[model samples]
Target chain A: MSADRLIEAYLNELATAAEALPAERLTELIADMTTHIAEARADGATSEDDVRAVLQRLGDPRDIVEAATDGLVQVDVPPRFRLRDFGAVALLLIGPFALVIGWLAGVWLLWTSDRWTRGEKLLATLGWPIGYGVAVVCDWTSIPLGLTLAIAAAITVAPLIPLLKNGQPGRSATRTRLAGATPATSSNR
Target chain B: MVAEKVFTQLRRGTLEYCVLALLQGEERYGFDLVKELGEIDGMVTTEGTIYPLLARLRREGLVETSWRESESGPPRRYYRSTASGGQALADFTADWERFRTSVDAILRRGNEGRRK
Candidate 1:
């Protein structure tokens, strides 16, 4: 293949391998690699063999991507079966029956976790108790037992639906403040 | 493989300071830094690794970058060491001298032992 095509293919592989990287940072990395290749060509790397040699000297794309991510604080989201998730679910489920202590424990998990947003946490904190209250009222008013149970189940499951959606966690207030204090133009200095 | 592993470990430990030392002379773009480092035997094997290292250094306030228009191609981002980077390099240089001396002494002793 031609030099340009070879470079393109290599960059494509790198981009695919580094899909986890932030888009802006990835773009900057690709630009740097492109500049390096262009300079190499300018400095007597003309033939296909020369291009191959240049790419080889850059090492494997996987290794480059690994190095890029090495310093990051990786947040590996636990799977549904993990103790944390199970505990979160269990706490929310049994919160109403255990009174204030159980409910506060569930709320604490929601608020402290980086996984859920403030809005989601607030909804969860309020939703379970209110749902349980309604269910209790229905039970007292001679409502059908199955209907009361269904209402309780829906309320318990509602807050967890947000957890299933795939996306990055919303930044916490402290993180936002810290980012703001760092000058963005420092990179240009 | 063992030699390569040891070289890589050593490079990982010292390459960042080398970059700082280079920048102490003059501001250089990514390609310039890579080319200079690559000229030294076993200093840099993979040319691409320098870019990520530069990026990390920039993020850590050890280096700063500015874009300048090149006469030939598009604009190039030149990197220079920051004050913090200079301080770090100074500290590392002192530490490196002590460490190298200690290692050399041990190696010389071993050589004398083998000669006897």
Candidate 2:
């Protein structure tokens, strides 16, 4: 094959290998390689042998892309489940019995803590207070107090269903996907 | 296999500093820098990989690059050490010296023990 064709094929392979890179970074990377090849040709590397040697020295496209993406492969460290979070969940469930101030403290904990996501916090906040209010209203009406309490208890505990999965908070699926896609020991020896 | 792994790890640690060290004397285009690094025995396995490393150094503000007109070809991207890069190199130099001395002492003791 001609020297130009050889360079084209190398660059095509590089693009394919670098598919995971962000669009801007991939463009910059390709431009750098193109210029490198052009400079080599200008330096009298006109022969196919010389061009091949240049590409060889540049090494495998996969290795180059791996190097490009090395920093991006970092594993996201999730915040550890702490005693404060446990306390937050506890207050969320039982704090209202302490004087309603306890539940307010629990709401403060729920919002301030990072253990639960925004959606989870919202559910916990709305479900516990509103559900407890519904139960109080039922007590004031003709409905039996025992049945109303049971319904309130179920509603209050429902929010914990997602939080208690495997006894840990939910991890971001995007983080898990990224970590799985780029294993740290992926170097081709 | 073990020695090869050691060389790979060592290269990863020192290769960027070597690039920064080269740029300390003068600004050089990408091709020239890659060529020089490739010439050093066991220094670089793949010259193409240096582009990514260069991109990272630039991103971190350790190096600055500019496009310069080339007489024989397209404009070239020339790299030079930034103030931060120079400081990092100096810090690495001190740490490397201490690390090398410690490794040399341990290796020498190991050799002496084996000889006995």
Candidate 3:
């Protein structure tokens, strides 16, 4: 292939390898490589061999991408339909016969996950128990057992509605923090 | 291979400072810095890696960049050492000198002991 075609192919590979980079950063990286290639050509790298030598000095695209991404910590958002989430939901929804075990497992899932804040987790964990407690109290107060139980179940499940619908809780916090920091940084510029 | 790995580790820790040192005298564009660092043995294995490093340095406020029209061809982004970069380089240079002298002394003593 011609030297220009070879450089284009190398850049295409670099773009694919650096797909995870932020768009602006990826553009800058590509622009830098293009400038570097151009400068090399100006410095007498006319032949395909000379172009290859220049690219070889740049090393592998994968290695370059890895180096760029090194030390960056990304927040992991869990998928909507994880088995753990389903299991926790199932345990919470089950009748009070297995309520103790189900509540413990649900609480465990809530605490272990990075998806929810501690406050959200506490609300969800207390939801069913509080509902169940209210149901028992109503039952002792001469209220119809069936109606009280239904009301209790509804109350217990209320806090979990947001958790279920959102699938992830702390995303808002992350987004807001990032949004808040952006303006401050831009204002300094 | 082991020696090369060790050298790579050492270069990784020191390459940013070297870039800052290069920019101390004159502002250089990306390609210019890449070419200079690339020529140094064990300094930079990959020319592309320097671009990312430069981006990081820019983000960290160690280097400032400005776009200027080149004498020939398209505009180039020239990088110069910022005040913070200069101070960091000065501190690193002092630490490097002390560390190098200590290491050199130990190696010399080891050589003398072997000769005796």
Candidate 4:
């Protein structure tokens, strides 16, 4: 029932439910669970046991994780709305690639350049969707209204690709970066 | 109780093999797999944990899924391992046996040393 015990139970539940999740992601979920327990207990609960009790009442750990991660990553593109889904796919296509290109350019400029190159520093930041934008514009003019939305959807999804691509494990660079974002869970070691 | 010990035993190896083996027979709903693994003597994972692994496996083309209508409620995503998964599982199983015996021999040697 105590806060510590609540966290412990929540972590155990999350770890079990999220067994498929990577070590870093599991750690992140645990950290988030800690935050949830803290917030739930913040209403003047004196001890950790009260927090644990609150977690018990909140239902299964699977339920919590199921909800938290449910729609967060999903685009929820309706199948019936073929146009919209296409737009979403188009959006996804160009967004993150543009973001990564821009980010890499920024990093290189910051490290290599002796002085300000207006284009490298400024124009590169605009790279987040130059690819998707061009596609969207083409769709807008040529495609029907329904199809236009498909292009838009793709653009919208672009930003997530870089973050997701970065999170991929088995990549040496990814593992090194994951070391930073990872929380204090048993999986890290 | 089973889940915790299974997790500790996972170490860095054996996980992939177990997963492939589990899905080798038939497609299973995600939560069902998690629950099944939990009941098993050597797994300590939750649905939350399994989902991410499922995603990665799908990305890697090791498994595939389809949304099937359920009798009781909403459609459920069912996962089944691919042919590649079978080969991978076989390779992993063989490698694990080799490693396990090697480690067991080393430990036994240490115990023998202590007796001496």
Tens digits of per-residue lDDT for model 3 on A50-106?
999999999999988777765454444334446776666666666346657766877
Report the CAPRI category for model 1.
acceptable
* Stretches of model 4 off by over 4 angstroms after superposition: A1-189, B1-9, B45-47
How do these models rank on DockQ, best leading? Answer: 1, 2, 3, 4
Q: lDDT (0-100) at residue A101 of candidate 3?
A: 75
Top candidate, metric lDDT? 2
* Model 1 DockQ (Cα-based): 0.34
RMSD of each: 10.8, 11.1, 9.8, 19.2
lDDT of 1 at B101: 100
A1-189 per-residue lDDT for model 1 (tens digits): 588899889999988877767666678778888888888888789999999999999989888877776555544433333355446556776876777777678777766666666687677777776777888888898889999989877986787666546312434312210012232232222
Residue-level lDDT of model 4, residues A1-189, one tens digit each, is 345655676678767776544465567566544543444444454576665455554457776455334323423222232233233323334435567554454444332432323443333334345545856687757668666656655544454344233322222222111123222122111
Q: Cα deviation of A5 in candidate 4 (Å)?
A: 19
State candidate 3's DockQ. Answer: 0.23
lDDT per residue as tens, model 2, A1-189: 598899999999999888767677799999999999988888889899999999998999999988888656545456464776777778888887777888888888778765677788888888787787889888899988789989889999888666555334434322321223332331111
Q: Which ten residues in a row have the lowest lDDT in candidate 3 chain A?
A: A176-185
Better of 2 and 3 by lDDT: 2
lDDT winner, 2 or 4: 2
